[model samples]
Target chain A: MTALTPPATVTADGVIVIDHLTKRFGPVLAVDDLSFTVRPGRVTGFLGPNGAGKTTTLRILLGLVRATAGTATIGGSTYAHFTQPMRTVGAALEAASFHPGRTALDHLRVYAPQAGVSDARCREVLDFVGLGPVANRRAGGFSLGMRQRLALATTLLGDPQVLLLDEPANGLDPEGIAWLRGLLRHLAAEGRTVLVSSHVLSEVEQTVDDVVIIARGALVHSSSLAALAALAEPSVRIASPDAAGLTRLIELAGWADRLEPAASTRPGVAVLHRVTAAEIGARAFAAGLELHELTPRDVGLEDTFLRLVGEGAIPGVAEPRLEGVVR
Target chain B: MTAALRTEYRKLVTTRLWWILLASMAAYMAFLAGIMAFALTQDPGSMTGGAPGVEAAPMTPESVARTIYTLATSLGYVFPVIVGALAMTSEFRHQTITPTLLAEPRRTVFLAAKMLSSVVVGLLFGIVGTVSTVGAGAGVLALMGEPTYLSDPIVVRSAWLSVVALTVWTVVGVGFGTLLTNQVAVIVVVLAFTQFVEPILRIAGGQFDWSEGMSKYLPGAAGEAITGSSFYADSGMAAGLLTSWQGFAVLLGYAVLFAVVGRVTTLRRDIT
Candidate 1:
């Protein structure tokens, strides 16, 4: 087996083809003509606002909900048509309950046979998620974080090449989040296709390689994280004893077009034109102006996400609102 | 298929409701037997004044055995129906069907496994109910100087066939539960049809010759046919009422019809 296998490295070429997928619940269109490709070996963050059809699209892709219009195929087959689905795609859509009275080991035991997973593999996955010690305990009393870990463990039981997780970090603490980031990275390194959907843009910033954003049941932006960040103009913040003098110097330097005062009550601080920190600093020094601080603010993923999804996308299309719950 | 069946069995075994239902069935059988035993121990001589009336006969092992079989089979169906209904309804109540369907994907396999498991559990409960009734009856009848021997083929066959009848009845309940997919609705429909409507129809069928054919198809009347009893003895149709084999076939047909309807509904409907 070892000699016949080549090294596992996910290429950017593996694509998830979603074509003309549409789903409607009465008057509301949950997912409307939504289409996107999540490439392999890259952590693709599916970002959207509270009711932007993120979860609905994922459900349709998983074949949990039938689409009203189109098709979502993974590796050229719908999830329902896959003969060895567990081996092809591992999905964790929601925090599912295994009989509350059953121990964790027993819970997995019932599913392992159907998934074609062995007993040893169950132990391996349990160990992977750090739940080996609590394997014999009833899952009813498990903490939310532990339940999330167990769900992840169940998802990994099939050793699938593709992963589709919806809000995998919802209940996790910071340390758990960090652990998840590492685990996802490790999985990607092993050439698996990992797709994660979350509204928390900051949480996925360092973890995801690319992003596919949607709003109002429509695609907003789809691109690499770096490319999206590069579109953001650099803003400079200057703190000086002489605000007037700094303003004059900045105007003379031909960077006064985008200049604005800093929105703070403190005196002697002004926001300058959207220019690089280095350029502003050199000009201030050249004009003999005293500058206490000159800092560059790089746009974060959150800024890009909000701007693309909140401001750019069309309004008034009703996506399924997760009432009183973070879905 | 075996894996699915195993999982279903595991789920049923682990559920507290299953155990409670089993205990309830046992308790009901014990209660029925206790009443019969108490009645059998009473002096038949005192009631008849040591004289034989035209319509009355002395209690015998065969007569008591027949009564026990009738009581056990008739009363035994309630528990199995309740158990079967809860088995399917709990998945919907707990919202566990989503994960189950996601795991299996093939809807038919999951449903078939559940149906088989329900039938097996129903069969087991039937046997337990029959044994408890017969054991109680035999012990009481023996003490009363009317001993029933195990070698009597008719009595043995009655007990065994009672089990078969009870199993088929439970499967019918399972099918109804699957079709309705609501615990309250299924239970209500089952109780209404079996208790009030069927009995009234059978009484009407006995009085009116035109309705006799219709009454024969009613579940309770059909059930009576299996137990070798006729709800309409005055109609003269009781003597030619369905034979045991025919009764078995009719019961099986009811079970099969319900099962197919349940299966189709389960497969076509959205689990959520």
Candidate 2:
């Protein structure tokens, strides 16, 4: 029951827009022609693997890094246009970016004034982030989870309309993660724009409403979580004493196209995509195939992420179809 | 702008570095002034002022007072510079610049606030350093049965100018620190340039009439000139220093140059 700021008025003011954002550090392309929109009232996950330009894109949006080409704006303007940026968009880039010598309160005090906040608000934010008990403790002695909480507290100092967090769940325990998920959902419900970035999709799989994924400095997929899940072909795992006969029976029934050759690692086993377990069971019964085991398997977000990044062996295909992927 | 300044001031006070620098600076000024006062009064002209060709002038009560009161700038200016430099470098050292810029995105305003706040702390450093040097030097002079000359106009002016000089040094530190983002590198450069390189050049400059003209414009000489009373200059060891206003202008020039170059070259660059 850490209470945060009152809900923001529902509007387009907190929307973050990035149009053809490209960044090049000397010879390396960090973000390439990236474009996306994070709207209000939703928890959008900016997902990508490590070095997939997730952090770079956030940095550009925050005005920490200069975009080589294109623009990133919040509320129809660049981050630099805001006089008191913290009040508009509070960002938590890295958790360990605290001065080891400063207490958590002192750290907040340093930015409170610039954010147009009072000293009492610093204490309030520390309390809201569940760090009220250790408000006087130096950040150096705190645990990683505590530091992460401190960073979040710092972002909440101004009660910003938008929150851009980079890997917020990095060093949290399971309980802490659950607490964070609730807090994020609460903030999103408050009509605030929450864009959280993480390398692994599973970490934020349960929390995010929309997903924007990238790989190798280029956009791969951007859609609702349900839309990404729709790309996953539902499959049924089947194991029978007459696996060869079952395969031939399915082939004869014109369901051979659904067979996943990559998933069938051994004889007497086959995985059929886009088919229900009951249909498979009825078909095996009709074919008089000896049954051993049949179970429906749902593809998790982790597999979808790996497949999107061209790093995982897609279900039925021997080679990953990295080219012409959904973008 | 006021909020930015307040934030920068808060940033300085929350850390231990500023107070530590102030304490050390006061101690250094007092000890150095005390030693120089004792040596000068005990045996006049016994020690050479290290001028290669110029004859050393014997110490008098008036000159001794002037030199002692100005020790804060002549010898203790580095402390304020360290204070100012650390203020900027700590952000980089801890990667706190991310949040700092997030709060105030205007780079020029952020740097300006840093400069202004450091000036405020620099003024404090100047007060402590001048007080210690004047107190110890006057005490030593009084112990030697010599007039401390505390109320003399030139002596009083030197004391206040010493404070101003140290304040300017603090601005110089901020600029240098901004230009050199690496904490260790900035510290090393500040210590090296102030302690070894500049002093050697200043001393060697006095050895020749040609170098003397140019050496008087060096940062240390400019600082000492602002006070209008350097132990070396007053004792006839170094000569042809700039007038007080000229010294002030020159010092401010250095501050502006370092700050502008740093702002353009490094401060505006991507902060990753």
Candidate 3:
């Protein structure tokens, strides 16, 4: 029942800092000694599989669930200790409902005053999430996607500088997904920290600036998305009239590792080793090989994610019992 | 804390269920009053039991006050209890507690706001319902050639004190609701214990003088003490029940105990 000590620093720029947080549900270690920092002004995608403990970690950070053995702080204070929590950190942990009989406007109206937000802010947030027209409608009849939008609007009511959303895109349509992505980027642009957890890595592939992937209740990789992309092996596709000559040139260049030929649809084409396309083109030019086309096949985020989780690139830990569920 | 209380009050006022319950309370009380007025007007001699010159004891202030007290004390206990239970249970059932806690992370503020709103609405509805019962009953009684007036001190005091008791009852129900955290459980337990078990125990206790002392401590007896009518005393059980202040103190003690326990449980437990 004792409260944890506050962290050393509380700043708007330091959105969240976790120091070896651990949470256990009975015998199950839901989240292990997981530590990561989410910087301000970027969408940090908390990437993990279904049982990878992403939600558990977020719940611990929000103080919704007590950590069994470590501390997490936001703005240098535990979430429960924040005097004005709404203005400091806005979180939507799960899809929770308001009374179905209450109108959308009434729902926010009741909660807004407690957060010290003006009534006008409720309408503004509704409009911000494109829920203005249905503001007066009863929330019980709203579609799941509409509820998702309202939930987001609820989080935005206090105009918090940090946002934590768990699987926000779960029920969104394509247009809604695009809107959310743009909205997240817009929030980040305004120097607000946004941490969004999603099982679908492809959805956040373009939306997030950085990612912290976890598997089996432990960190697997923590780096910028661009850095992960750079670390991925590249593929080079080359189309040439003299395919054999180009293959011989690639072999001579000692880039024969993991080389495979192109499909028949592109006749006289040789897909060279899993090296950067620029390097393959540079070698072809040096060998005086005639090349009709050279295209670099960018690695998909799914591949990088699988590689990280599968390879257990995380710094430390014993094998977890739930490792099979991570993939 | 004030802002949170305002929000809670606003929510309770705007909720359609609260309005529906209020209307139902009024209708039930009015219906009962109408029945009494009709019976008294139609058969004027029945009330006086054929006493010579009794001639339909003309709906005196005491009679009207008695009716108002009976309705208020009885229905007052039931309606406020239901309303208070719903106030908290609805949030839990609808999963609105998560957002509410998020908005006001200090659990104490949320519970206090809810308690304040319940007290205000309970008292307001109690007064409105009591006054309507007396007014409607008096009107019908007068139209039926029987006279009743609000000027009687006892009638006025009964109406006012009923409001206080109803408010206290609402908070008690809310405390039970918080402790149980289940709407059905609170309703069932409150209804069964207050209506059936307490009266039976009071009766059984009367047969045995040793148990008579315990009977006065029952909720029904304590509640009757506030309304200035002892059903057990009339039934030949106890000589005297608790005084008004003593009864109020007992009810308040029960409410505060439950409320504190509920508040502590809500603060310590996970929102999920």
Candidate 4:
């Protein structure tokens, strides 16, 4: 999990504001009234399942796909309004879009003039993404990972302030993923905003300081990663010969509201959430139940994520929702 | 537009496909000129069921040179058109437009750049085809002891005009490419129209006499008019053909029509 950083500054420039963005393809709603703000100074993860409209939302922001309703703006204006958009926001994965027959250097060089950057920037960015060794190679012969790197290099050519990357980690190997994480972190550390979208939680688990999670094309959870994990209570697990009695005593001791059977290979253990190990042992001592083990374990974000996306959410906690969406 | 054009120009030269296409088109033009030179060298009496010694027109050196000039464009115009179409549709096929649109998000500017660049390529195609045909045809005519009037002002004007005409035909191709982004579909339709459909319609129009007025407006006849090739009119195979100025106007109209439809589809629809 990422350590929570200081709140990002919401200035008139750099931050991205998505307000009630909606997109409809005939009757199927690709993006449904979605809204979120991606602030600079941190890497923000846009998490959702495969069909949760992650790509659609990103495309809408870049003006690749027009939204049916609402607005997605950067620096208080749409992407099209930017005088030189390549410098305002550089989107990766798009640069991967190239004529396969051209050399990688040729591919990058074509974009240099229009982006208002010098040809040297193209060469520099290729080196930045570790593609300088294969600069003369044809893009068609490149592996998916290499293609991803080339795309990232193109975005850097203009040295844009905000970056929008969609599923950039999809085809990357484990080492590539680690390198990409470090690169993204370094970019964010430079006070540039980075919005990376992926369906897998584990991929962004350690890299993202803040996350915008969605399900069925709507926002479900929006906050820091640590805050989402904190929603799940810390629990203690106990193994005893008299498991039923221990559970009964725990109920009588007033921790019943958060008690659960801890998943274990052995048969005599009940895990409790929001209950301390000391409290359970005290109650067990008073009830005269002998305990073989009393262990405290932390609940992970995986559990919180499952529940957050599922039909049934965690009980008694405020579920994240859009303005007009029903709980 | 200059920046975008420069970018597009760099993109075009980097790819080997464009170079290969240009070389092949030039070779085909030379082959055509060779065949025409051989046929013209044969005895005129042997070519026709002669009434003893009825000569085939005043076979002047200028007329023979004019025939070669018109043949260059009339026979080889489709190649450049296909190249233009492929240039436009290849981006969509490869999905490269995503990045292209991202760098320059405005569709109109990006597409206009493509169009302008494609026209310049079309002009290159014209130069190659015209040079190949005239070079080979004059060489063969000189070998046959026919008067090779390469210095004739009329022949010079027609040859240069044919090259310019070939370039415009390519703009028409760019329109076709944008109108139908599908590579195979555009190729099939263009081939069918130029090879079978238009030829059949032209013959049928001449035979039936009802559609003759419209056949003059067919792309092939308009091309012949622009090149000032009276091959069809002198042969009595076509009548009611438009003047050279009218042909130029009609060709521009077709280009505009193709461009308009393509612009609408591209502008209104999503790149995805």
**Which one is best on TM-score?**
2
**Cα miss at B236, model 4 (Å)?**
4.1
TM-score of chain B of each: 0.81, 0.96, 0.81, 0.89
TM-score for each predicted model, relative to the true structure? 0.82, 0.94, 0.81, 0.89
Candidate closer to the true structure by DockQ (higher is better), 1 or 3:
3
Which residue pairs does candidate 4 place in steric collision? A262-A271
lDDT of 3 by residue, A1-327 (tens): 011112233347546898898888888878889999999888999998888888888867777677888899887888878766777777887765678898888988988777788778888888888899999999989988888998898888777788999999988999999999998898787777899998878989989999999888888889999987876776767788986887688669886666663342455676654677778778888888888889887768788788777785446655567767876
Q: Show pairs that collide, candidate 2.
A: none
Taken over the whole model, the C-alpha lDDT of each candidate is 0.72, 0.88, 0.76, 0.79
Q: Quality of candidate 1's docking, in CAPRI categories?
A: acceptable
True contacts kept of each: 0.23, 0.85, 0.58, 0.74
Superposed Cα deviation of residue B49, candidate 3 (Å)? 14
Of the candidates shown, which would achieve the greatest lDDT relative to the real structure? 2
* Between candidates 1 and 4, the TM-score winner: 4
- Per-residue CA lDDT of model 1 for A58-136, tens digit only, reads 8777777788898998877787876656666778877755667777777677677667877788787888788999998
**Which ranges in model 4 have alpha carbons more than 4 Å from their true place?**
A1-11, A93-96, A235-237, A250-269, A293-295, A312-327, B43-61, B230-236
Give the candidates in order of DockQ, highest first.
2, 4, 3, 1
Per-residue C-alpha lDDT of model 4 across residues A1-327, encoded as one tens digit per residue: 121122245344779999999999888888889999999878999988777888888888988899999999998899887767887788975435878999889988888887887777777788877888999999999998899988887777777788889888877899989999998898788788889998877788888989998887789989998888788767887889986786678667776666563464455677778878888888788888999989988777877776677754437646466788754
For all the candidates, what are their Cα RMSDs to the real structure?
Answer: 5.6, 4.2, 7.4, 6.2
Tell me the interface RMSD of model 2, in angstroms: 0.7
Better of 2 and 4 by DockQ: 2
Ranked candidates, highest TM-score first: 2, 4, 1, 3
